[model samples]
Target: MTGLRVSVGDVVDFGAASGDRNPLHLDREFALRSAYGRPVAHGALATIVALGLAADREELARVVELSVDFDQPVLPGLTYRVRRSPRGVEVRLGELRVLTARWTLADRAADTAPAAPAARGAGADRPGPPPLPDGGGPRVLGLAELAGLVDESYAYRVDSAALAELLSRGAAAGVPDALTGPLAWASFHTGMRTPGRDGLLVGIRLRLTGARERPAEVWSCRAEPPLVHRRTGMVTVHAELDGAASATLTLVSLLRRQVAAPTLVETLGTLPRSNALAGRTVAVIGGGRGLGAALSCSLAGQGARVLAVSSTPATALTREASAERLPIEPLTCDARDPEALTTAFSGVALDGLVLAAAPRILSLPVAAATVPECVDHVADAARLVLAPLAAAHELLAERAFVVFVSSSAVLEPPAAWPHYAAAKAAIEGLAGHLARHRPGLRVVVARPPRMWTEMTNGPAGAAGATPVGVVAGAVVRHLLSGPAASGRPDVLGPDALSGP
Candidate 1:
């Protein structure tokens, strides 16, 4: 099959159709703050697209059993393709398999005979909160009410013209297509009826019994008691559909861990009042969000005039700094553009420079990563680091210091983050080279552990992550104490923050 790209419009349309309006797949700001760093396509939408590309209309209509395993989130703007495997079909982004599916087709022909539509119900469009494992009973929803939650017409448009035609034909035939209403309902069942708001669906198993001759008007869905695993925070729910069509499905989902936004007050309170950096002027690249924001506050609190340079405007940071009367100025500049960086710092003389800008962290295994994927990540990091350093050279004081924000992942690489680890490792090497080449300059490399930031806000991403404020405090304190005596770009590990 040709390479297919899922666009933001596609994701939004699917959400309208599937009633899976989880902010992770719809809201850009919400997604940016979540672990994904951007909006993602729904797993069900991906599954349907894969199925449509893999099989013809007849095969899809005769599907008796289907199972899909979501290996990774299907993000928009990336080209994906469907490959027919020995067992079924796999949806891949570059070399990485995002979803895998297998299905069993019934040998017998589908029953096309029209039958009486089931009685329709007037249940609430938006149902109450889903039941937990320890409390509440099952939720019984009517087909009309469930369908009303999201646009069912848009569900038919899963990017395949043939699939959409088949769905329309099935609707006209008075049959509830297994791949349309029922498929969308499965998403609604997990996202709304079982795990509610925080659910991240990981896998699905669906079994279709005898085909319905006609669509059931008042079809009812009942979710069995939920099974929540405390250790893994995984919730498994079994839902059974009855009325005109009979089917059973199992959905496995994980609850996302919420990471609270760091406050300027909390961060400033963590550091002691010291004038070690007094009268010094520090320029912090990527100082608008995450660790950069915390560092800007910490540095300003310690009596340094800080230039918070970022690609985007840091309105909130600027407002907070103003209210607190801190010597922090927010400057918008793309660090990748040397001219822009130079222009942003034209008149300022820097006593110190902190390279803290980086791309969003994503999990892509080495085998699945293409050369361009790795190169792009490494290139982005190098540009963010090198451009600022070059721009600051003409503005540096006689004894200026430079701090390169590397990562612990470089020392102990993650299997799923070869690109990220490689980029950090390359920059760390550059820092060491710069330290050795410039004998008089003080260069420090900080390898901080996973911290609570939008970049690491997913369930697994936020797990055991250190607070950004805590790490910022340590980094500020280190700046005051000076670099190690060894002198070849004094590298600070995770232990540097573990004060005595």
Candidate 2:
């Protein structure tokens, strides 16, 4: 990383390039009334500066984790020094720290490597604006459309014009400048315009310089030619309004696409319930709420004696069980505590096992996370999967089924989710290993995408999340169907529940 002198003109240009219409950087009136008292460079601009400095040295095409804090404002016409940090980089204004950031490097391939394709973050480090409905605005950028414009770059202005219609429409629809859908495209397309192998935005961390907000009516956005490296590339963009930097973005781009190996789950349509599970004993860990609750009900309905395991039994689960006239026994246990789990499942001959417990997610950036903290997080989740397998794997009825409710996040690592994803990935691996080694046991892994559960009711959870019943049904379907002859454990992807 290197120190660089920045000008007010640089600030304005950044706003235009990143299409961050926030008035705090471009509108003097807005800044005067706000806490800053004057226009301040976007805090993300410092992040861009740090990223650009990193690109000069390391091949950071796929950043695993990024953390940035805006301690002070970086005003226009000031010089800032960017220096290396234990994690990533930091920006300073003389003695005051303007912004500090740390980044965890993704394992780069020896050759041109693809970025992590499944690297979607849960609103932790994504570029602003948020995803919004189309709302009859100008066409949004799509992958197919980006392919056609291989060498071309499109510029967007903030005024009420065809090029910037999306912004204007978003503003009219009460969309915040940072959360405007078009603005998201503006930041992402910067990578598409850069000439090189495509990459995804695996991670980002941005902080506002001041309380200033709003965007200038007139704006400019442009993507610089990507700085291509042997294994990675960096795409820089600057957005400006009225000759001031509103936002600057530097994207980590890899040279190839990432593809994961296929799991055991078949993508066939939903299979009907049968008496296959009748007169059998089953247990559902973390079955008090969300998909776990749903699975408990479904298993009970299928005539399995359901043991709904949770820290405490929820009223909803009890009510559902009673209403459905299904037999469900609530078992209290903390999976993280081995003694508690042992007591809860002692002497239980499980015919089917559903392990779906998880720990409280800190969701901290990798930079701030300690090794012990990460280990503990993974261990907590592991207990849910391992505890049941350990307790009942040998004692289960012949031809019994064991299902670990995994997450699809393992396929596409989400930002700030390394702990959770790692645990799920490990579970999947363990399930596969058990299936291959233990011929008599039916091990099934369910990699459900974001489900409409209480834990995932946020912005990311609101869209594309399958119903809880769908997740539970898919799990039971695989259990009833017996072990696949493919010599691999079934991995139920989200699509497994797409049908009736």
What is the Cα-based TM-score of model 2? Answer: 0.47
Predicted candidate 1 versus true structure: per-residue lDDT over 1-500, tens digit per residue: 64445668777765654556667788887676666767888777777766766766655666778898988888776667789875678977666778988988777547662233333235523323223233333233332223334211111111222224333332322223554555666666565555656677888888877556755433466666667765566777777766445778888877665545455665655577556678999999988878888888888888899999987788867877887788889999898988898888988888989999998777666543245666787899899999998899878876678889999998899777888998999899889887887756788899998787878766566567777877887888877786543458888898875332
Q: What is the lDDT of residue 113 in candidate 1?
A: 26
| Model 2 misplacement above 4 A | 1-275, 368-370, 482-487
* Candidate 2 per-residue C-alpha lDDT over 175-210 given as tens digits, one digit per residue, 9 for 90 to 100: 223212123444334323332213323333322121
lDDT of each: 0.70, 0.54
State, as a TM-score between 0 and 1, how close model 1 is to the true structure. 0.76
10 residues in a row with least lDDT, candidate 1: 151-160
